[model samples]
Target: MRRQHLAEEIEEIFRCSGGTYGSPKVFIELVRRGRRVSVNTVAKVMAELRPAGRKVRRRRSLTRPGRRPAPRISSAGTSPPRNRNSSGQAT
Candidate 1:
């Protein structure tokens, strides 16, 4: 009777939402239509219908590997001429 009619209306709303409308959205829509239905009731009906929602796809990484490694620089000072000796000792 009343329950069956409500179930049909819920199904219609679910379809109209591209099958992405879960119980919460359906409950809001039913309320907006002046229907005095509870969210739990809508959720129960939706469970019975089992409409499939859209799945979220994972994003791929944008960074790529470089062919050559970067050159390492000394951290002691800037790129000015060094005052050290050729024997690996400071002058």
Candidate 2:
């Protein structure tokens, strides 16, 4: 009866926050509205609702390795010394 009403209100709050508000924020909102609710209860309700937030995309690497293998420096001094370009490619 009363529990069902509280669950509905929690669901509403979760939805109103663009589905980004987790249990802590939801619990705070409920408390601010003079609702006496436990954090655990809010967490439980949120788990049941399963509202999803936006997924964070990982930043792409700007300096990926080139297809060419790096030229090895020879200790035997057989090969002529090579100048390296800004991209670490042998010139």
Candidate 3:
């Protein structure tokens, strides 16, 4: 009986936030409205109701093929290795 009322309240808050209010926000709203409810209870009710918020999608990187040629790195051991300590300081 009480759960049903709480569910309704949760739904209303979720709707009011344009479905962006997840469990935490809903729980805070409930508390603000003078309702004695735990965050866990709100989370459980939300899970049961399944009112999911729309996730903000990340923007895809717009990369264009380089017009200039890439700098060539010589992998061949052309340069002599430097004697460095474990701390990377030149011995």
Candidate number achieving the greatest TM-score relative to the actual structure: 3
The residue ranges of model 3 lying beyond 4 angstroms of the native Cα positions read 58-91
lDDT of 1 by residue, 15-89 (tens): 899988778888999999999999999888878878755665798766665755578876786666668888888
lDDT per residue as tens, model 3, 23-67:
988899999999998889999999999998777789886775666
Task: Give per-residue lDDT, candidate 2, residue 82.
Answer: 94
**Top candidate, metric lDDT:** 3
- In terms of lDDT, the poorest run of 10 residues in model 3 is 61-70
**Model 1: lDDT to the true structure:** 0.84
The digit string of per-residue lDDT tens for model 2 on 32-67 reads 999998999888877787765555579998677776
- Give the TM-score (vs. native) of candidate 1: 0.60
- lDDT of each candidate versus the true structure: 0.84, 0.82, 0.89
Q: What TM-score, over all chains together, does every model reach? A: 0.60, 0.56, 0.61
Candidates by TM-score, descending order: 3, 1, 2
